[model samples]
Target: MVTDIIAQAFVDFIRRVCECENLWKAHAKDLELAKVGDEVTKAISEGVEGEYGPVTVKVRKKLLGRREVRVWLYGNEIDVDALLAEISKARSRAAWLLNDCSENALLETLYKYEDRYLIEVAQRNLDKVKNICAGELPRIEFGEAPAHVVEGVVKGVRIYLSGHGTSA
Candidate 1:
């Protein structure tokens, strides 16, 4: 709790410096925000690691054309990053189902595979998935799935929303 507060304060400090730079753009030296972020991470990391075992703090560069950059504090107890990746894949599948499958077909598919759903996630995430079914389908910005995109089955289809709509 104390560490969280301190971390937030450090984040606020960097944000203020950026705000000042924005106000005096040409006058100000461009702050190496990455270095500042690294220092903040180092400052707070030791206590956190002592409290929780084998913690890693990562400060990432914001992606090009992206608005938000995040700091991640990970504990080595379990492979949380791998777990997050799996859940992210599962959540993407759920969103794909919610968007691509028709209402009747989706309910029937869910009914048929209720056991699969239960095995996949807890109630809170299941509720998040149920809420996903309520929204309008997202217009996919990409014309084709990327080369790195994994192929997987959803509701007996070989891949989610195949172009020809045939099992492969």
Candidate 2:
């Protein structure tokens, strides 16, 4: 129960940093925000593993004036350098899309880019949640029950019967 509270606090910290207002505005078109929300839900469902968790993202590209520009988003563990690299790769692919295909052909590329970006943001938020949880848990005494155990046994009775004594 205490760990749950700590986890929730961590989520709240992520929410504060991610900002609902910005998140809403960022995905207002075509239920993009809704999709991002779903991804976040999926990430949380995966639970915290070590310092972070993993999530999936989709990215796409849009073409304008003979040039295909890519947009990307993602959700998962935030590694800023890795994200930048993914973005760079997406942009390069977008260039190829522009050179070899029509505007309509860029649809998949645009979606892929956007998804990548969403995943990246989600990861950053997850990290924040982890940090918050780490900070809050030390102050509480939840008893020692092996750090690996997320839930402790409560309100349970153990009975042992012996020749000389009976215990419960």
Stretches off by above 4 angstroms in model 1 are 1-78, 104-168
Q: Single out the weakest 10-residue window by summed lDDT for candidate 1.
A: 147-156
**What value of lDDT does candidate 2 attain over all alpha carbons?**
0.33
Q: Report the lDDT tens digits of candidate 2 across residue range 47-105.
A: 31222113243322336623222222434444434544544554454444344333233
lDDT by residue (1-168, candidate 1, tens digit) is: 433332233223223333333333432211222223334344343222222122333333357933322233333333434433433454454444435443343333333333333222212233333322233122222224222211111121222223223223
In the predicted model 1, the residue pairs found to clash are: none
Cα RMSD, model 2? 22.7
Local error of candidate 2 at 149, Å?
A: 73
TM-score top scorer? 2
Once model 2 is optimally superposed onto the true structure by TM-score, how far is the C-alpha of residue 96 displaced, in angstroms? 0.4
What's the count of clashing pairs in each model shown?
A: 0, 30
Cα TM-score of candidate 2 = 0.19
